[model samples]
Target: MLKGITENAVQSLIASENPSDIQFDIVVIESNKKQEEYAYPCTRTLFPRKKFGFHKYFNLGISKTDSQYICLANNDLVFHKSWASEMLRAFDADPSLVSASPACSIHHPAHGVDLYSGIHEGFEVRKEVAGWCLFFKREMLDITGKLDEGFTFWYSDNDYINTIQKHGLKHALVSSSIVDHLESQTLKSKDEKEQFKLTHNDRFYYEYKWGKRSLFSYLNIKRKLFFR
Candidate 1:
């Protein structure tokens, strides 16, 4: 599943109007023994096989890259020609921006709400940049250390944004940089109950880490009060 989507993502890069302006390295973090092949133009590295988790692998990828800029994209995304340049412009325009991502339908619901609702011409500074397609300078890694391994999979993005903001940095969505995201395509084949459990646990962990009540707990109490 990821193999195909990753291939499409690479194709999108090659199809870009200014393909030559974009250079990238592919880092594949395999969770299984099956080795996927890439015919893309960039150097490729496959981390040792491990259980599926975003933060660990993302950190591993970051460690491997020596570029001044780093852009992380989920395998299930297709980039637009302007995606890289627009995000670059945003970073250049705002020295305070620690990270930036393209506006996409399949982004964090709150961050991309305007784009998903048909208003997509302007940028937005967001509380969190979705993990699916994130762009940032290497300097941010110095400040945040790394994505919290405590959030091995979920809420890592939230934790990442929070960490950056704590250091007086911000992230944004460059509206002109659009991408096609097939959300959760990476987990489509996973058991629903297991997925729910991870999400449920991660939500609570995130809330606790940030010193807030979990949304589920708050909603449950609200429901009980309403019924009473």
Candidate 2:
């Protein structure tokens, strides 16, 4: 898995179960000016400037991947040992499934469904999906284009999901595979004003592409911006 690592969470991941099965290609996204010697052998480190957003960093990792199936995941997510195998089975069962996301308990109010609970035994269309543990066919890069660089930190995944739907591609939840997500671990440090900008920009992009936004979407965006 490709993880954008901050110094804080690296130790916890190492201590988690079955770390050997996980080949962590860790990319450091911030504050490495004087820390050249601290890099680990297996860890692939990147020290991006504050101006570059998570989408840019994520795209950097995606560009380097050679696997036919790619998992674009966050560092805070912990996976089951069987995650890779089960997800592959789901994708292999239907070549039309452009993407398959892991089911989790966390619900985004905008989508009006608990993401993990929405997983079915068969294929289906999904309105929204989280960036954490999003598995996609490599060909999707050529089909929908890369993540929108215009987005600094948020909504890049949502934009990609929108593009997937536009191409009539299908996405589903692989119910058998699960990942524990430590929500907002990366973006939790941002102040209210910066957070608001992220939310507003996300909503604007959705409205620009879809032409209409749902009430749940509006409220969710507002909640993310001002409330938390």
Candidate 3:
């Protein structure tokens, strides 16, 4: 977490209206070994992990705790006071819900979802929630297993939903809970040229595992890559 991004995010949760009985824990899977510390609420553990891959860190983080409810959140999110309470209420109301994501109006436009725009009150069932923040029951891990570590960075979310749905699990977008996504903060730190290369690498791997998105989707990348 560059700057005080992770600290700010954690403190925001401490300032929020959390569930009374729920013991909020934080497991920091650091992208680099900066060894920064924060005065966060509840139990906290910091794991210095310089390696990349979304699932690799997430799976490791989850293993660090035994909380019934697990949330995989990005470092750049500023959570609203109502976010935690509202998200838990949704899970309590629907036992069938395996995973849910909070709505974030402050997310970057490139994130592809204008959270508050065209969104309605309460929960909206869907095949997938936004990748920035994912909240789910720990039992979900038992069913879907660890997300495919094969996904280097991108497409882990896509693969997660595919496995989730195949197991008859459902996910929802919790509009009542809101947060801010300083979208792709880590990716933004990298040069644009490198970003494209990494994204294409993930895309190629995704297609290799799941087949082409569609016949035409293959043409979206370089023709040389497509033929190769």
State each model's CA lDDT, in order. Answer: 0.68, 0.62, 0.71
Model 3: lowest-lDDT 10 consecutive positions:
119-128
Worst 10 residues of 1 by lDDT: 116-125
Task: Give the C-alpha lDDT of model 2.
Answer: 0.62
Identify the runs in model 1 with alpha carbons over 4 angstroms from their true place: 17-19, 34-43, 105-128, 213-228
State each model's C-alpha RMSD to the native: 6.6, 6.8, 5.1
Tens digit of per-residue lDDT, candidate 3, span 23-133: 477787666655555434453655544466778888888888998899998888888877877888888887777788888765423455554443232222221266888
TM-score of 1: 0.77
Clash counts per candidate, in order, are 0, 1, 0
User: Would you list the clashing residue pairs of candidate 1?
Assistant: none
lDDT of 1 by residue, 1-228 (tens): 666677777778657547478666666555545665334445464645566567877888888879889877777888777677777777777777767777774554545365523212223223235567778899888887877866755776777777877887767666667786787876776788667655666666678679798667856754554454
Residue 159's lDDT within candidate 1 is 78
- For model 2, residues 79-150, the per-residue Cα lDDT tens digits are 654666667777778777778777644433334545335355323333236566678888988988887776
lDDT of 3 at 194: 62
Q: Against the hidden reference, what TM-scores do the models get?
A: 0.77, 0.69, 0.78
